[model samples]
Target: MDLGVKGKTALITGGSKGIGLQTAIVLAEEGANVVVVARGEDALRGAAEKIKKETGADALAVAGDVTSDEDVRRVVNEAIARFGRLDIVVNNAGTSAAAPFGVVELSAWEQDLDLKLFGAIRFSRAALPYLKENGGAIVNVTASFAKTPGAASLPTSVSRAAGMALTKAMSRDLAKYGIRVNTVCIGLIRSDQIEKSWKQTAPEQSWEQFSRDPKHDIPLGRIGETVEAARVIAFLVSDAASYVTGTSVNIDGGKAPAL
Candidate 1:
């Protein structure tokens, strides 16, 4: 259906690929002006071009690192300058880091927090004034591990938990301004990141073996697609989800245990 987000402008971080890219495409298809932010200029431009070509929507790309406050500020400012206003913000920039606590270095934890937690805070804070002006939405992309931690998932789980708390706190505080804050807790969705993870963690395994239908961990017996997560995020940011806020929606294939 009509998501009712036409003409609305959205800024999405980590939009160069994976779920973020899919989200941008979907939003553009729904007639939203989309600004995709990522660190790599080439990939960001490619994503922007793809969105524009596929959906015939206005799509812009900005190269910036979410871990840097300056970059975050630049992204928000540029988006507003280009679109004149911001109606949605998707803090989707992050990487998955899993290591045994004992073996994990302090630096790793700090970096993880900088990217996953502080990144969202920076973008949300930067976009708050613009969002409040028009009553908009913010969707922070977190992980299911935040709700159910697993062994060796140290920094990621901890950082995602903090992100969930951030979402709740922002939702409560921003509600008065007509701004909604929520999160999409991702599960095992197939993406470039997952491919890299498999290559790094199990180089010996063939792609078929590594990507074989879940038929295991996830109850659905298969991994999820990037577009699957993107659609949920699109709904959360659309007028359709006007009443949804301060909540976490797991985009897993029923893989997440906690309700």
Candidate 2:
């Protein structure tokens, strides 16, 4: 199906790997120019090269920290310089920093909020001008835990909750300008970190076996792939979902209890 994103430009934060990189590939395959942002220069460049080689999309790698306002501004300016316009912004840069409230330090909470919450705010604010020009879309990547918090989940859950709130507020404010804002609350998606855990915890088991161990409690009986989450994000940013905003979609294989 055509997503109607041809010739459009997209900017993805934390696009060097995992869901971010996969999302870039999906958008590029659909004929959109992509700018991937991350702190690691080498990884970002490699991701850009992979997108170009695999999808033949114009991909730019921008190395910068999302927590830094200057870096966020530079990333947006650089994207506009490279693509001349921006149609999609994916605030995907974040880490899973969770722990019990008693064990979590003030520094940890501050850092988590800085990266996940303020990071999205910084990027979205920086890209607002260009997005306003042509009516674009913003997809903020949060986690399912944001909706249904469990024991021992602290900074991540709180920060992601803020992200969801940010999405709703942005959607309401940006709708008049024709700019759509939405979010995807993901769960148990496969990534390098998960792969490492799988190997370390159960090296004797096959990946298929490990992912379906039932210990993870995924209702689908397996971990989700990056492309799975990526496709949902791609659809959200595409013209096909023009009417979707001020909402959050759970890409959690039905694992999130709150829906």
Candidate 3:
């Protein structure tokens, strides 16, 4: 399918690994110039190099923390400066607290929201004008946990739920300007973050236990792959999805039940 976005430019936060990296690769493969942003310089550079090598897409790596306003401004400014215009913004950078919600300190909860919720808020504000001007797209990368809201996921779930709200709000406000706003609620997917999570939760679990069949907590039985999630993200940012806006498309394998 021709996404019809070959010469456009996209800014993908948390683009160093996992779904962000996959999104970068997919967007570049479809002919979009991508600016990859994350905290680790090495990982950001590595992701850029790999995307360029594999997809032959023009990719730039910007290392910065999403929670910091200065860092966010720097990354966004640099992308606009280099690309001269931006067509897509994917709010994918986020992190959770070290401990689960109830057991953690107040600071932990605050930090979690700072990264996932407020981070998206700040980035959206920073990119809004450009999006209005360019008639671009915004894809907020949320999680199904926002819907399930488990006990062990207090901080993360709270912030992610807010992210979903922001998506709907943006869709309404940005519609007149042709800046479509949508979100992808991710279920369990194969990524470095998930591997780290499993290791922390159950170190003894083997690779077999984490297979990609629809056998996991998801009703479909297995977890999703990063690429699987990436495809949905690409679709949302593509011309093929011109009419899709202000919607939270679930990428989970039937794990979430909201209709």
TM per candidate comes to: 0.94, 0.98, 0.92
| lDDT (tens digit, per residue) of candidate 3 on 102-178 | 58778877888889888888888888878888689999999877877866777778788999998998899889999
How many clashes show up per model?
1, 0, 7
Error of 1 at 161 (Å): 0.6
Error of 3 at 180 (Å): 0.8
Which candidate order results from sorting by lDDT in descending order? 2, 1, 3
| Ten residues in sequence with the least summed lDDT for candidate 2 | 74-83
Kindly report which residue pairs in candidate 1 clash with one another: 215-221
Tens-digit lDDT track of model 1 for 42-148: 99889988998899886989999998888888988899889899999999999889988999999999999999999999999999889999999999999987998
Q: Please identify which of the two predictions, 1 or 2, would achieve the higher lDDT against the true structure.
A: 2
Clashing pairs in 2: none
What is the C-alpha lDDT profile of model 2 across 146-211, one tens digit per residue?
998888999899999999999999999999999999999989999988999999999999999998
Which window of ten consecutive residues has the lowest lDDT sum in model 3? Answer: 207-216
- Provide the lDDT at 129 for model 2: 92
